[model samples]
Structures are given as C-alpha cells and as structure tokens.
Target: MTAGFFEAPRAAEFALRNVRVPATLAPGAVAPATQDGHLDVDIAIASGRIADIVPAGTIDVARGPDLRRSVVWPTFADVHTHLDKGHIWPRAANPDGTFFGALTTVMADRQANWNAADIEARFDFALRCAYAHGVSAVRTHLDSFSPQAEISWPVFAKLRDRWEGRIALQASSILAMDPFATGEGDRLADLVARHGGQLGCVTRLAGEDHVGVPANFDDYMTRVFELAEARGLDLDLHVDESGDPEARTMIRIARMAAKRKFKGAILMGHCCSLAVQPDEAIEATLAACAEARIDVVSLPMCNMYLQGREGGRTPRWRGVTLLHEMKARGMRVAVAGDNVRDPFYAYGDHDMLETFVQAVRILQLDHPMGDWPQAATTTPADIMKLPATGRIARGNPADLIVMRARSHSELLSRRQSDRVVLRDGMAIDTTLPDYRELDAIVGMK
Candidate 1:
C-alpha cells in the first residue's frame, strides 16, 4: 500500500473518486455545510490539506476506477492514553475486578520486572495498533517518576519521531507527588521542555495501605502548577482515580487552576469519584472546572471495570464521571483508552471504536430516534485540541476511515469492520480487498 507523503507534495490537483463524506462537519456544532450519508465526492489535496471537495462526477480521472460503495470519515484523534503503562505487564485475570487489586498488581510488576527494553517494545506495539486502527493523533502519558529521564524520555522521543508522518504524538510526563518531593518533578519539567513533552501529574499516589499520600498532595500540586507555567506546557492530571468517596483531589485541583487563571490547558482524567458524589457537589465542581477551562477525560473501560462494587447491591456500580453533563455545561470532554493489556486493564485491544462503544453505554447517551455514533466519535477530537481532525471538510487533512457498514448504528453495534483507512490523502490499504477478508487479517473477527 502507498503511504501518505510526509512532506506536502507540489502537486496542484488530486482526486478521490466515489467516497461518501459524513453528513456534517463537527455534526453537532454550527459549521460549514456538508452532505450526510453516502455521496460520490472528489477530494482534492493541495499542500497537505484538502483543497476542495466536489461531487464525484466532476472528476474525470483515468488512472483509477470507481470506488462508489466506500464511506469516508475523519481519522480519530485519541485525546488521552498511557503509552508507557498500556504496554507494561501481561493481562492477568483479576478475580475481584476492583481498582485496588489492579493497582497492587501494577506496583508489584514495577518492583519485580519492567525495564527500558520492555517499555519500548510495549510502546511500539501500542502505536502500531493505534495507526492500524486509524488514530492519526494521540496524547500519550509517559511515567515521569523515574530519575532516569536519560532512559524513559528517549524512548518516547524516538517513538514520536518514528510515527511523525502517520500520527501526531503528544508526550505527557506523569509525575507523582513523592517523586516531585525528591526533586524528580522539577527535573521532569526540564526534560519536558528539552524534549517538547507536556506536563502531567498524579495528584494522589499510592501509599503502603493502598491509601493516598495525603501530606504531600497539596504541595506537589503547587509545584506541578508552577512548573507547567514556567515551562509553558499543558497540564493533565490523573486526579481522583480511586473509587473512595473521600477522594476530592480533582475538586481541589479545579479550584486551584481557577484561582490561578490557568486557562484551558489543564485536563483531568478519570475523575471517577464524581459519579459517586452528591448531585449538588458534582454540579458545583463541574462549574468550577468550566470556569478553569479544564478539559475532562472519561476512561469507561478501565474505570467501569476497576471501580464497580461486588454483588447486585443497591449502589451497584461506581460509574465514571458524568461525561454528557460536562459537555452540556460547555466544558470540554474526551474519552480515552487509559490502559490496554496492562495490569490495570486487561481488555483493551487498542481500538478507539471499541472505546466509543463502551462510552455510549456508560454515558447512556440517547437521541430521540437513537444514539448518534458519529457525534460520539467527533466530540472527543474537539476536546483534545485537535482542530484539523474529526471532520471532513475542504482544506482539512484528508485523513479518513472507510468502514464496511452502512450506518452509524451498524458501525457501533457490529463493533468490527474492515476499514479502508487513509492518511494525508493516501489509501492505507490500496488492495481494497473484501471487508470480511480484511477483518480476518486484522483479527477484528
């Protein structure tokens, strides 16, 4: 298959024959008009951006034949993921399916095994999976607690370079409180600057009894904020990941960002405790988050699997943060694959399509006729600050995915398809084989 041009070619005209464009750009928002469902359109790529999209019949091309049955949508922009952790450890069956058990296993693995080579191998695998799945852009969290920035940072830097053409990689340094206290935090910030990585923080770190290190939480967060400002870097925190009712770290962080006018650079991932909070409190906290311009990310697969309670009890599940509510409040919200084949989450196969499916069920998003799958996929792109992606429009990058299915519901319900993927206007699989055969090759079946 021909890969997309890394550097924009000098070509004046390019044509995509018989491709169906999604009905709208940013479907829910007020944007330029675009025909929905199936259509035959000619996508002209000039200087790496789509120059114009004309009706398919407008183009008179001789080199290629008709591709009338294909549908094309924007390539996915994955807002949140943990490339470092996603590749660590094997997936072991957790009998209890509790968050604490998963945490314990991760800690044990860190102590027992896991080195640079292992981490690099896993990271490479995850990136390959993402590209094959049509994720053109991703924000990945890399653990920064280690003093060996000489080691960890380089791996990520190399990975970033390796996938430079196919994907946009944003590296975030995942700093814990204790490590920052020991001077690793400042060092991490420096490394982030040197390597162009983003700043990340874990407001609470695991203690001996599986409790949070309370004494250092506030002080560490202060340093994190300061460092982010000093480095002019984006701040993303894994705040309030615990199912514990008392975990109010995210609320405090939101208040701090607001007081300091940090703008919209802050992102809070897996604020799972919000689901268990009182309605009034959740609303108030969400208001503060909106004011702070903080983005929120919900990891349905990991949070749902790790936090839910046992038995058919009254309070059965400790659901993820209220995603739909946050979006309604005008706060940015994104869904992420927090872990894949890692100790924390054994289920993810590096497919955001699967992630979206789980998110729809967890968020209970319902339309009058039915749930809107295209909207679900598009919303997260906006949240992640990925402007070029998530929509099909003239002058936009021609990165798109063509699913075998006919409609959004069919795509979601079936959850597996042989997609004819494209990047930078180049067909990922030029063979254009049957969807069923392609599905088997990708192990989607």
Candidate 2:
C-alpha cells in the first residue's frame, strides 16, 4: 500500500531531517543561507501542521530517518488547465495535430458527446490524477459556449464541492470574444458569478477570418472588462495562443486593463506570439503588462505541440512566451499543465511536477534554476488566490512532496515516480487511475 520513496511516520509527532528544500519555500531561509537555491533543513511536524524547521542537524539524529539531502517541495498548484476538455484524445484524436485540428476536433466532440455525466466522469478522473500527483490546487478553464457552458459549469460546481478538502478547485469560462460583443457574455457572466467562478475568454473573435486580433478587438475587450469589473470577478484569458508574429493582443489587453482601472486580478495564458515579436515590441508589451499588474502563465507543453506546426516542416522555435523577460520585469509568471490527453495536446497526466520539468527544458529555466521552481508552486498558488496551498512554513499544513532527487540534476533527469506525497503529514495513495476505466465511456473498444 505504500507508494512513496518512503512512508511518512505513523505517529502524529515526528521530524524529517537532512531534507533539501527550495529556499524560496522556506520563508526563514535568507539568500546567504541557501546552497545553490536550496537549504538543508530538518522539519518537525505535529498534529498535521508544520511545527518547526531549522538547520539540517538541529533535530536529534534519531528523531527521523536521514533524507540524505532529498529535495522536498511544497505540493503544486496548476493555475491554468482544461479539465472539461481533458482526456478526449481517445475518441476525438486530432486529424493533423495542428491548431485548427485541435479546435475542430474538440468542437465536434463537444457537440456529439459532453453530457453532464460524461464530463463529470472525465473531469473527476483528471482531478484524481492531479490529487495523486501532489497538486494541492487547480484552476481549470471550462468550455462555455452556449449550452456547453450550461452543461460544464454545473458539473464543475459539483466536483468542486466533492473535492473541496482534497484539492482546491477554481473554474473560469472560456469561449471566443464575439460572445462578449453580443449579449452572451452577460449571460455567461451571470452563470459564472452564481457559481463563484471567474469570467474568461480567448481574445480571438468567432469567425472564418483566422487572422490577427480582430478589428473590433477593443470594443469586445471593453465589454469583457466591464463584465468582470461589474461583478467583482477576476479575469482569466487565452491570449495570442499562436505563432503568427502579428498576434499581439496581449499588449492591448494589458493597456486596456490599465486604462479602465480594472480592480480585479487578470491572468493571461498561452501568450505564444510574444516570443516572435520584435525586440521593441516585446519590451513595450512587457512594460505594459507590468504596469497593469497582469499575471502570465505559459502552457509550454500544449504550445509546443500546437504552435509552429505544419504537416512536414521542422519547428524553428519553441512555442512558449517570454517567461524570463516577464519574470525579470517583476511580473508574476507561472507554468501549468494545460491539456491532458486531449486533442490540443495528446499527452499529460495532470502532474505539475512534470509541467515544471518540461518547462525547465523548454524555457531554459536552468543556468541556475534560481527561483523558477516557484512558477509551479507559490506563483500559481498566488494567482489562484490560495495563500496556504503551495507554501512550506511553520504554521501551514504539512502538505509536501518529498523526492529522492538530491539536486536539480537528479530531479529533472528522472520522472521521480517514487516521490512521496504528504497531505496533512500523512502519505496518501499515489496510484493513477487505470486508463481502461475510460475505454467504455470514450468508446475506445
């Protein structure tokens, strides 16, 4: 029944000694105290909360097993994901693996299937996978186009209640901007507010004209901002999720937020086009984003699979946003698991650790690793407004992931399947759901 590298002590009071923890997670560790971005510490747990943390040998050596410098991380928070659209690749595989292919396949699947029960089954499965992987919180984007919104939002509410104590769940509405220009945005906003969810949409309008930002982009953007502001709800948007160098809606959104004095938090995801813009444009956009206090989350795995993709050509650039530039400008940036086994991305397990690993390589977050690990843990937790979800402090719940990987080199080199996930200082099962369980539901005979 034990599934971790080591089992947590059965007693309510104990300590884990000689563990390496990210310095950023340990509020007490100063820059000078870190050994290459990590600090060796002994953590004492009592009654399901972190009791104390001090230098490696501060606790009696016999109090706990020597972790031998194993890296211990705060359990993760995935701030941007598509739970309603996850795990559809089984029956609705993308024909060409292009952006349009994913869009069309997901739309078709939504129409043909996607009833409440069907969605609840798949969404619950994804959450189970996330919980088992040590994710303490998640914010998912629901496909809120007309009836789909009606169907998906209720299911999300039910699951949110069901998984309340296990994983903190938040949902945001996702659709094209055209709805906001019309009156559908108001209707959707009402539904979102009733369910205590965020108002969101993609910047692109709904039509055959698949060019850059729409000519009426500002008009619709105004509506969306007004809608969110009126209801005191946050905004989570899909911005410029393409490689077309001209897709520059991100800067416009940031500027609009500042101009309107929008008080609610705004989180923009999948800003892939920023990477291809001119240097001046990039700097201007980043400055605007910083001034507006906009948070950015890059979906590296999904962007890589969908962007710069043509039938038979090599992808010249990695399809991620300017994470380093944005971070350097004092903006909060995060990495998240966007789609899991869906048409948009054919592979993911709802594992934020895996997302961070892939992001480190895709965004070149190494060179020092620095505080990049926060992108998955603290950064996303802050974005999701869950202060206690992804932190390792004396008064916080002892929800943590302990891995045998002593250094970043070892952490990133292997999958870390044997890692231990502790919730309330107790080890829970890490077994993933059987894929065969979905065979019947997905029609995968």
For each predicted model, how many residue pairs clash, with residues at least 3 apart or on different chains?
Answer: 2, 0
lDDT string for model 2 (314-420, tens) is 99889999999999999999999999999999999999999999999999999888989889999999999888878798889999899999888899999999989
Clashing pairs in 1: 23-36, 50-395
User: lDDT by residue for model 1 over 1-445, one digit each (tens)?
Assistant: 5342222223545665555555644233222322234445656666557777777666677523355535566777777787776644333345456566666776666554446775676677777788777777788877665644566788888888998988788877765567766567777888888988778877666443223336767787877888888878888778777666667777778888888887438878888877777888887888888878778888888887777656565446746888778877877677877788666787686677788778777777544213234433565666556677778777677777766554545666774556667677655642322324222222333
TM for candidate 1 is 0.82
The 10 consecutive residues of candidate 1 with the worst lDDT sum are 26-35
Local distance difference test scores for all models: 0.67, 0.90
| Residue pairs in candidate 2 whose N, alpha carbon or C atoms collide under 3 angstroms | none
Predicted structure with the largest TM-score when compared to the true one: 2
